[model samples]
Target: MSINRQIVLASRPQGEPSADNFRLVESPLAPPEQLADGQVLVRHHFLSLDPYMRGRMSEGKSYAQPQPLNEVMIGGTVGEVIASRHPQYAVGDKVVGMGGWQEYAVVNAAQPGLLRKVDTTHIPLSAYLGAVGMPGVTAWYGLMKICEPRAGGTISVSAASGAVGSAVGQLAKSRGCRVVGFAGGPDKCRYVVEELGFDACIDYRQHATLDSLQAALREAAPQGIDGHFENVGGMVLDAVLLQMNAFGRIAVCGMIAGYNGEPIPLRHPQMILTSRLRVEGFIVSEHMEVWPEALKELGTLVATGRLKYRESVAQGLASAPEAFIGLLKGRNFGKQLVKLI
Candidate 1:
């Protein structure tokens, strides 16, 4: 139990992530055998694997700094505090914070926004890293704030069965927007429509071409898309652009189609001008002030069963790298998590 095992960034990915990009190692936990002031030791129960981590894996600048070579891969975790030198954090308190890709984290209390307590009595702990956490906040800000979808109006989002996308569609529907989703396959499409209760879902794997995607979008959203949450860029964005209603809003949450280093070109710039559309790219951390309000709503929705989600769980720390690669490949159906304990 004293060995802290972690997955570290070994190299930058050339195209898609592979085994060469990550390496796992173990180090003795608390080698000095003493707790330092302002340090809290947390034993990770679950770690979240998000698309944003992909951006951090690459060398270029984006919203976050790249994952430093030989360092533990960065991720969010829900853990129980085992030792606390900080008065603010008590032993046995459950907290959600950046524990990285390790089983135990000795986190400093001063990192401002990095650590916070969460109540798991009404919600599952893993969910704090998903539906009611960063991804959910991302869905809320990008949809309610940016999209502003109205009742009876059609709204669409890509990767609609994934973490942020699923929440986006559900939130839109709760507001009475006719919701349509773009998922990768027939199974995910079924889950989006039947389980998540979206009005319609497009199996984008079947509609691989831009023309086909336009056809599918037109058929599913016959009223014309009033708002869009853009998780996928490239062909999907271009196709959705053509079907947008005049003055429609697009919240660019993520462009996962190109996250693996491929260049995903957006083809229809003319539509942005012609439709007088509003498009904005957002990072959830940039809008942290809205988290409390957003989490309250999301938590209530989940507790009441009005909001639902699925998960792809990898059972151990050793499985993190492969599971992450699966996530980038759209092999994961919903939120991807690693069980570290």
Candidate 2:
């Protein structure tokens, strides 16, 4: 029997999750005496920590189901196939899928959302969980399919230094769009503008007001924002709404500001009608059909050094909860990953 440590939801969080909400427990893993036809045992390597996990802590109807108390926390991870009863996946294959917060997982090879083997030599294995994975695909399809940015158009992206936002800004820049980014601090803002090639970057935390944001937007995008990649919804969304040009496109990727359970108030709902702005919310999973193509493109960009990515890696599963809370607080600089040896 093998023993594995896993992080489970100990209690439902009232607002922002504290350390008390999670509990790490060790369980003895006994292999099935009779092998299931298509089951495989996986050993997790890198676990993804996303902002969406915050919503899963609360009991409510969301895009994804909430995690029940005492259940292993849900997350995407890159793992290696340790044992396989399935013909499709053999032992020693590196795969990516939803393995939750555990050292080992039993998965069906033919399952709808089972692990998919990837070529890690072309790119780092962790990139599969970030850029070449969900966040990358989210930025790609969200901008192309949802926002439909035109060449030479001006676009604004919030959380500009983050995984998804960074991809959005860089992709827009490569497409000849004037890309403006909104980040928390001066360092992040500088990184976005200098490293990511953004036309301008606003330090939202420094300015801290709608008027200041609008003024910055006017300075960055004098013609007005033709497209906006809305990562942070609350006040930033409200401010961007006022600066949007006619028939502007808005891809609502995430609402990190409101993820802590605070009610986010919208100052202007009429901007949608007046500017004929197209605002749409989407989940990256919804565009699974084009995963192969998106990965190919993003991987090429990363290989050629046109696209860059960063990760805030927390060492060990014990640090996952703290890393998760830090992610919600915007303390992480890029894609947050929990490294498990």
TM-score of every model versus the real structure: 0.97, 0.97
lDDT of 2 by residue, 1-341 (tens): 38889999999988888999999999988675445889888889999999888988988878988898898999999988888888988888899999999998888878777778888776888998998888999999988887787888999999999999999988888888999889999989989988889999988887778888778878888889999998888878887899999999999989888787788888998999999989999998877887888889999998777799889999999999999999888999989999997
Please provide, for model 1 over 1-341, each residue's C-alpha lDDT reduced to its tens digit, 9 standing for 90 to 100.
77899999999998888978999999989742487878888999999999899999998868888889999999999999898888899889999999899999988876798789888888899999999998999999999999997989998999999999999999999999999999888999999999999999998888768998899889999989999999979888988999999999999999888887788877889999999999999988888789989999999998888899998999999999999999988999899999987
How many clashes in each structure? 0, 0
lDDT of each: 0.91, 0.89
Summed over model 2, clashes come to: 0
Give candidate 1 regions above 4 Å deviation.
31-33
Q: What is the lDDT of residue 24 in candidate 1?
A: 92
lDDT of 1: 0.91
Mark the 10 consecutive residues where model 2 has the least summed lDDT. Answer: 28-37
